[model samples]
Target: MNRIALAVCALALIVAACAGSREEVVEEFLPSLESTTTTAANGDLPSTTTTRPAEDQQIDELIAGLADQVREIRGLPLALPPLEFVPGDQLEERYQALNGLKSIGSTRINEAYLQALGVLPEGDSAADLVSFCSLPGFFDPESATLVLREGLADLTPYGRRLLFDELAGAATNEAHDWWGTMASLERSGNTEAAVGLWALVQGDAAFHAEQYVAESLDSTDQFAIRLEEIACQQESTSPP
Candidate 1:
């Protein structure tokens, strides 16, 4: 290559190294739902108070942060439209029960998201299977951690952190910012590379993704070769 061309390529690589994209950031950080605090009007001014204990309030704020994260997902680009068209404000209604998190409590929230995500999209909307595939902690492509984004309104920061900890460290890095990068690939019809990321997931099951894999992959040479490669690598890496 010519000098100017080489310099240009070098600069492009440098730029790529310096910049962090949204998905890369998502993969790297488990965001806390930001907390809000109140201050007295003026040092001497008095403030109204509630009967709830200080710890209850603190716990409440922690849960609020998690709810904020769940709400943010609605703003992200979907892998596909929801199983059926849902109005924007009412989207949370699909995975959670009414009255917000009050009814479900802390214990059942994760299971709710898992059950919802594992079910197939049925008939025409079947391709929507990958819609929930990149949820940060819940969909661990490495260890095959289980869970989803919806039904998070009830989860405390501790609960959210537990799920975040379950994520396979290898899957949530610059090289595998699957949500933004892989989702786009899937949208563009690059099914092979997109689903191939699932190979990073350890367990045999992959919620709704299994439907797409089973229905799409026939006894074709290319698909078979790819799966065999995944299996071989997994076995070779298995510890003694």
Candidate 2:
């Protein structure tokens, strides 16, 4: 499948939080990365809370919003891969092909997204990674597994700041370190979650309201390239 389809599957599976087999060490240490701070704890942090109800439709929209942000960074137009719409004769085969996916319900997906993306109901001392982002809780065993397997828990506290806080400044190298980690998430030829994670790496401050990174990259490819290089030191590390 093409990268865009890979990305959609990644996002769908991301609700259950799986990456690839390769293990990597976080290359740099930013102090305070381990501290679990809430937006309530720091008024300066962008509020993860939204006025919208923390329900499925709202949360799905929010998750989609983040996913769109990553695709913009990678210069991907919003489109699913061709294979997603299997022929009628092949439908059951495709369903069985996708059966290995973990059975995380939509409500759980919404809750994890709300917590990971919005920093809600905050009181836990330790955090669990539900996607490329982290949430504080032992609420689900699968989520805990995802945290350790993805090394989401192991990333710098600055990572938590970047993924959840919405506007923390990370050096160009720091950002790419994140980019590399995200790229590692694709498996079963799926890369959707990595796309969303890329957006989390690029801070919200980089965009104006209603603007997208794709449009910006179209105008200045070098600028985006420089940002990735500064962040990860790799040449041409495009997001899925």
Candidate 3:
């Protein structure tokens, strides 16, 4: 197999392994989901509201900074789209809504073919696995929007890395019209080529994101993120 095919195979196995341990991974890097108590603005009554943590509220400013970094790293002028943060419960809904524009039957056929080749586990749809293993945010090329999962304001190393990745994706889209290219490839019935292109695009974003992390984050954060990546790789290679 070529490099892209090898990368896709590796990613498929890693995602399969990760499906069983997602909660553990999340708990290790993300804060607990307990609601915070806040006092009323008037200072007379203490109303219990599940407000976003103060630290998490800086997500917008952080994303703005990330966009600038992406531009610098990619050396491309980027027009960032409007950003939206959706609750965890709505993640799949949003994903499916965006996915609706694509050919679901084609996805299913591809999933089955991969499973037949042992690239993907039986009984696991590509769509489901992708949704499960994807980062907490994505850039919607069709809508020209950056959508993130709420509560990323804590700015954990993992969260920061995700921001960089998504920003890079946005930059890539701006420069190359990612969705349009993929759509054209699909329309031409070049399924294998389309898959290869998808992998290339994602890999490019990931490479730039890592560069951003190395250039911008503190040593401690960089080390923590690297350790997390190593752990996930180890898990993927471990025996079942």
Candidate 4:
């Protein structure tokens, strides 16, 4: 009888230990296992923002300046050190530091990455610019001058005229400029290279022009016609 009772007691102890183990697991993991949801800005997935104390902001500026010096010494382009190099938890702070160094411009940021990615076309350029790319987001082959043209209402007449002159002379520096070079190459019957550049410019312009139309009440189809003209030129000149 004692042997049987001892066996029952061992079984009871095993059941008790299992119950305690389950209880411990519940206590340890239940809080973290609660469901979580994220708040999105427009259609984009939630992004984290890092806020900087005033002193840290100054330090970041200094570090960025030092980084610029190092880049210049190596004969690299004058732009911000990549994000991985920046010291910050806040994405905005890092972006700002990078922006201060590169000055790559808002148009490249807004119309290039976010809108092109279709996440937030209306995203602020100053907010989202990056340095370099494992996959490059966008390339604005148009110079600052060409961007000033097309009577798009955002640029001055003098600017537009200046860009037109640059566009005309682009054939000479065709090596450095894509759109201008492509157009020139097309004139010279280098249809393949022209097609490549045309694809890029047309893709970017199609997105931006559509964005501009959607955002503004302005009925100006000026940009649309320009895009259409470029597309038609590409199709006509492309060698099938």
Best by lDDT: 3
Scored by CA lDDT, what does every candidate get?
0.29, 0.28, 0.55, 0.29
lDDT of 4: 0.29
Each prediction's RMSD to truth:
20.5, 20.5, 14.2, 28.5
Q: For model 3, how does the per-residue alpha-carbon lDDT over 155-236 read when each residue is reduced to its tens digit?
A: 5676678767766766666666666766665687755444444545566677777788778889999898767656555554
- Segments of candidate 3 deviating more than 4 angstroms: 1-57, 96-109, 127-134, 227-240
User: Largest TM-score belongs to which candidate?
Assistant: 3
Ordered list by TM-score, greatest first: 3, 1, 4, 2
**Which scores better on TM-score, 1 or 2?**
1
**In order, how many clashes per candidate?**
2, 13, 1, 1
Instruction: Give one digit per residue, the lDDT tens place, for model 4 in 1-240.
Output: 011222232233223323333334323322322221221121111111233333434323433333333222222222231212222233234323322322432211213322333433354552332221111011123422111111122322222222222222221123234445545655775443333333333332233323333443144454644444455445444675
lDDT of 2 at 7: 31
Error of 4 at 208 (Å): 1.1
Once model 3 is optimally superposed onto the true structure by TM-score, how far is the C-alpha of residue 197 displaced, in angstroms?
A: 1.3
Off by over 4 Å in 1: 1-162, 165-175, 198-240
List TM-scores for all candidates, in order: 0.23, 0.18, 0.64, 0.19
Q: How far is candidate 3 from the true structure (C-alpha RMSD, Å)?
A: 14.2
Residue 155 lDDT (model 3): 57
Clash total of candidate 4: 1
RMSD of 2: 20.5
Q: After superposition, how far is residue 16 of candidate 4 from its true place, in Å?
A: 73
RMSD of 4: 28.5
Stronger candidate by TM-score (3 vs 4): 3
User: Which run of 10 residues does model 1 get worst, by summed lDDT?
Assistant: 74-83
lDDT: worst 10-residue window of model 3: 39-48
Error of 4 at 127 (Å): 41
